[model samples]
Target: MQLLLIASEVFPFSRTGGLADVMAALPESLVRLGVDVTVLSPWWQSLHGQPTEVWRGSVPHGGRLQPGAVRVGEVRAAGVRYLFLGTPDFERPGLYAEDDVERFLRWGNLVLPTLQSMGLTFDLVHGHDWAAGTVVAHARAAGLRSVYTIHNLQYQGRWNFAEGAAWSGLPAAMLPDAEFYGDLNLMKAGLVFSDHVTTVSPTYAREITTREYGEGLEGVLQARDAAGALTGILNGLDLDRWNPAADPDVLPMTARSGKPANVAALRAEFLLDDAPILSAVSRLVSQKGLDLLVEALPDVTRDWNVVVLGSGDPLLEAALKGWAQHPRVRYVSGMNEALAHRLYAGSDAFCMPSRFEPCGLSQMISMRYGTLPVVRETGGLVDSVPSDVGFRFSGGGAGDLSAALHAARLAWDDRPGWQARVARGMALDFSWEASARRYVDVYRQVLGA
Candidate 1:
């Protein structure tokens, strides 16, 4: 089956969060399952290499026609075809444009026509997040099967309805479904108009249908769930990218021998003594429950060496900075792929105390690296890590997290048990093959095959 996957960013080409990784891996997995896949993404300036021009077209914007170009590229790692949409609006430095509404509106308007211009036909078009929601809407309106995946509900693209309607070039008749109160919601458009809606995990799928986690779209999500059009498929990890034994960046180690040399290297790197290490690699935002970490720093650092790598939110940065001054604590405020691999390989425990995690890849990566994960019991965290394999806390508070960390530290003291837990986690499969098969099933169901 031919499939078109649309997203704002894709890994190794452009990326900001987990969405890029998902888009990168899922398509490749689908290809391996004998499905023909094509990806559609914006041509961000930061993207490496240039794509060959495939199709040229125009889109409506601000009352006039604006010229648009489509360039075809290939992800060498996945051997999948990807098309880049290029226009003056997409030549910006960052992945997201300052005028996101207008930028994605133009993108949504141009996607279907661009596909037609290239004489490409697909059995299904799957869109990721609010950025590609409008594109899914357009595809569905044109009588094509469409799927929309909500990576994160918190980032719904909402804009003034009147202005959005004008800029989006969507008819006034469709405004009611697209509008939430007085604002135009791109996410709502996707949720309301798409043939099916999916989230990253089953728990998250159920969570978003309620007011607590719905971000004001609970009614819509509940309606979708009632109609049996909502699904919660757990996200998968790219084993090739995350395997500890094969990763060149990480120090050579096996599950049997343990990562002593790497642990020593990490201790030296962080200027810490030989203490049990707890590491975190995540955005320093409230959503990630960094504030809880900050609050529990005093208790956590008293027992274990702490290392954190990430950047986001000024207040959280400041809190992490303060904690970094501690002799047993080290903080690196940016993205580093190599260092991340090293941390995963060397650390005794990994922390992901997210207030709500759709499907956390870090915990999965940590598990693959034979490191125990200490996470809050929410969304995918609860599904991915069993109690015997990792530690989990329930309440979204620092106290609860501190208790869980203490439990992990106690587990660390039991060398045999801890190693057994690590072995179990490593042995568990978080591969994309199963996920790909499920996706194919979804495609078949949508097409009535």
Candidate 2:
């Protein structure tokens, strides 16, 4: 099957979040399953010197034909073709900002036409997140099959009709699905126009159809669910990229046998004295529930040495930084890829107490490294990290997280039990093969092929 995968961000070219990783990994997986996959994404200032094929096209916009040049950078990676589309406005310094929504909405007009100009054709178009939805919407109008996946319902890409809707060149009469509270919600357009809808995790798929997590599109999603047009496919981890056997920064450890050496290394680097270490590699955002971690620090740190690596939300950053004053609590204020691997292998436990996680990669990585995950029971965390594999707590309060941490400490003290839990976590498979097959099935079902 031939597939055109559209995304707002593709790793190694542009990225701000998990969407980029999914875009890169999923296409690779699909190609492995014998699907002809082509990924399309926006070009940004970060890609100024990258290799690409350039072409000029004239798109009709604002009651006139607007002449513009579109750049298509081509790269063949992991058996998939990646196309980065660029225009003058897209190259203007940033991938996303408040004003970028309208620009992206308008960029939808550039996608299919540019592909046609390049003689590219596909059986179906699959779009990701909010920014790329218009491609699916456009594909639907043209009588082509399309699938839309919501990576996170948190960002819906709502915009004013006058400022951005006019750029789509789609008449207001043809855009009833895009309407949300008298405004244009691009995510709604993607959901309503696509042949089928999907989210990152099954739990998240169900959560988003309810008022609490729906973000004001519950009615539409509820209808999709009733019509059997919605699916929740769990994301797969790239084992080769995250495996300790291959990662030079990390020593290969199985079931915590070799974890002590790495733990000593971490203690030496962070000036931490001997106590079981609990590490977290996450953005310091309220959504991540790092604030709950801070609240539990006083009680949890009495016995555990804590180290956190990430940066976001200035207020949360400041609060975490304040905890750095304590001898056992170390907060690294930025993202370091190598350090993340070390933390995964070295820490006694990894904490991911998210308010609502769609599908978290960290817990999987931690489990793969024999680092037991202490995750709250919500969304993918519940699906991925079962109580037997890792420590799980219900409720979204600091006390709940503290209770889970306390269990982790008890488990740590019980070496045999902790090792057994680590072994179980390591035994779990998270490769893209199964998930890729599921996606292929979705493609076939959508196309009736």
Candidate 3:
């Protein structure tokens, strides 16, 4: 199959979150299955890797033609071709502006014509997130089969209908479907026009078709679910990238022996005394339920040493900042990949008490490192963290999370029980190969193969 994968950002090029990781691992996995894949992404100034310009053309936007070029990335990771859409609009300082409507709309308008100019043909085009949402609409309109995956439903790209219609170059007839409550919704366009829609997790896919988690698109998701066009494929971890066995950030592989050295190293690094380590590596956002962790910290700190690494939202940052003074707690603001790897490798237990997690990768990463995950039973957390590998609690309250941690502490006190759970976590496979096969099945189904 010739598959065109469109995403706003791709790992090793430009990345802000998990979407980039997905674009990297998924395409490679598909290619391993002997499927031909070409990835389309914007060429940001912050993009890594050298790329050679392959095609130059004009794309329609606001009733005029704008110059754009397609560049092929030199990285050439794992047999998947990388194509970047380079235009002056993307040459700005940041990958995205505060209001992304106009910028992404123009880029969306460029897709069909850009493909035509390059003479690139694909059996199917798959798009991810709101940034690539418009590709589904454009591809479907041009008679190409398409699939759109929602990484996060909260970030629907809504804009003024008049301006979006003008810049997007979409016809009046399609506007009704694209518009949500008088605003042009790029996510709605993708959801409506694509042949099939997928969310990050199976539970999340079900959640979005309801009033609580739908983000006001419940009816549309409900119709898609009824028509057998919606799927919830759990996101997978890149085993190669996350393997504790070969990870350079920590000591070489072992499910047991290497863990003690890493734990010792982590203790020395953080000035922590010998205690069962509990860590949370996240973006420090309300969505992640960091506040709940903060609330539960007073209860968990005496029994466990805590490590936190992430940056976002000032209020959440401030909440974690005070914990730095605590002797057993170390709060490092901002993301550090190496530190994160070490944290996962070293920590006895990892916490992700998210109110709503759309297939969290951290829990999977933690499990891959043979660490127990203390997660609320929601979204992918519900799927990945089984009773054997981790601790789970229900409800959004701090009391529930505190109880889960206290339960984890008891298990930690039991050496035999703790080791058994760690071994189980290591044994579980949350691999991309499994997820890719599912995607291939989706592709074949959409193609009527």
Candidate 4:
């Protein structure tokens, strides 16, 4: 099968969240299954390496046309071919902004033409979230099979109605349902036009068909669900990148070879004491339960040392700044891959108290590193972490977060229990093998094979 995967983010190139990790892993897994996979994403200046090729391109669609040709590039990583829609607009540090609508439309218009120029043919075009929704619509209009994966329905690209009409060639009369109050919604376009739709988890699939979690598109999702077009597939983890035993980040072999030297090395780097460390590595956004974690912070710090690594929302940064005076709490307000691995290795426990996680990657990666997770029992958190391997809270509350944290702390107190849980966590197979098979099944279904 020849598959064209379109997403706004991808690992080892561009990363904003778990979507990048998924984009990096899944295509390689598909390729290993003997399928031809190609990825399309925006090229940002913040990207580390040089592209394999660069070319001049022009895109025309919607109401306006970018007649002045722009430069685009291509690269390959992890067995997947990458095509980057490089433009002056993508030179910014951030992937999207107030000016993102125009860029998205330009890329959406160019995607298919770019592939054709490269002499690439695909049996299916799979697009992720709102950024690539218009591409899915174009593919469908061209009589192509498509799969649209809704990573987060909440982030639908909604803007001025005029802008929407200008960005998509779809007539205003055909987009009544796509308009939310006074704005055009990119996610609505995908939900409407794609042949099949998938969210990251089963619970999220059900949740989005409701008024609350639907982000005001419940009726559309309901219609799609009734039509037998909506489904869910839990996101998979790359165990090779997250494994504790084989990880270069976490060393000293094992207890049989040497004491846990990496733990001490990590603590020294973070200026944490020789106590159990509880870490949270995620964006400091409210949806991730940062407020709830803040509520539980005082008690958590009183017992185990806490280290947080993330940057988002001014309010969240201020809250972390307020905790600077705490002797046992250390906060780093940025994303650092090496530092994140250190936290996973040194921390006795990892926390993910998301209010509604679609399919969290942190909990899975932490478990792979033998860092027991204290996650709320929702979405992918429930699917990824086994009960025996980690502690999970049943409901949404500080009470829930605190109780789970306490369980992890208790395990820390009991060395044997902690060791047992660590062993279990390490033993978990989050490899893409099973997820790849499931995706192949979805591909076959799409192809009517």
* Candidates in order: C-alpha RMSD to true structure: 1.6, 1.7, 1.5, 2.3
The per-model lDDT (C-alpha) reads 0.86, 0.85, 0.86, 0.79
Tens-place lDDT per residue, model 4, 1-449, is 88999999888787889889999899999999999998988887787687865666554442233554455678876687888777666777766578776678666766777666656688999999999887887787778999899998778887788776676666455567567789877788788888889888777788788886787888989998999888888888886777666777667333232225766777787787777878899998878997788888877776788888999988888888799678888888889888898888777788899888888888877766667898887778888888998898888888778878877777788888778878777767778878788778877888899
Q: Write the per-residue lDDT of candidate 1 for residues 1-449, one digit (tens) a residue.
A: 99999999988788888999998899999999999899989877778777766666653332354543444444445568988877667776777756887778876877777667667888899999999878877776788998889999999888888888876766667778999989989999999988889999889999999888999999999999999999999999988888777789987667776577878888888888778999999988878997888899989987799999999898888888887889988889999999999899889999999999988899999998888999999999988999999999999889999999999999899999998998899889999998888878888888889
Error of 3 at 308 (Å): 0.6
Error of 2 at 9 (Å): 1.0
Candidate that scores best on lDDT:
3
Task: Name the Cα RMSD for model 3.
Answer: 1.5
Q: Give all TM-scores, in the order shown.
A: 0.96, 0.96, 0.97, 0.93
Model 4 vs. true fold: TM: 0.93
Candidate 2 vs candidate 4: the lDDT winner is 2
How would the candidate models be sorted by lDDT, starting from the highest?
3, 1, 2, 4
TM-score, candidate 1, is 0.96
Give candidate 4 misplaced runs (Cα > 4 Å).
59-68, 171-174, 252-259
Off by over 4 Å in 1: 59-77
Q: Is candidate 1 or candidate 4 better by lDDT?
A: 1
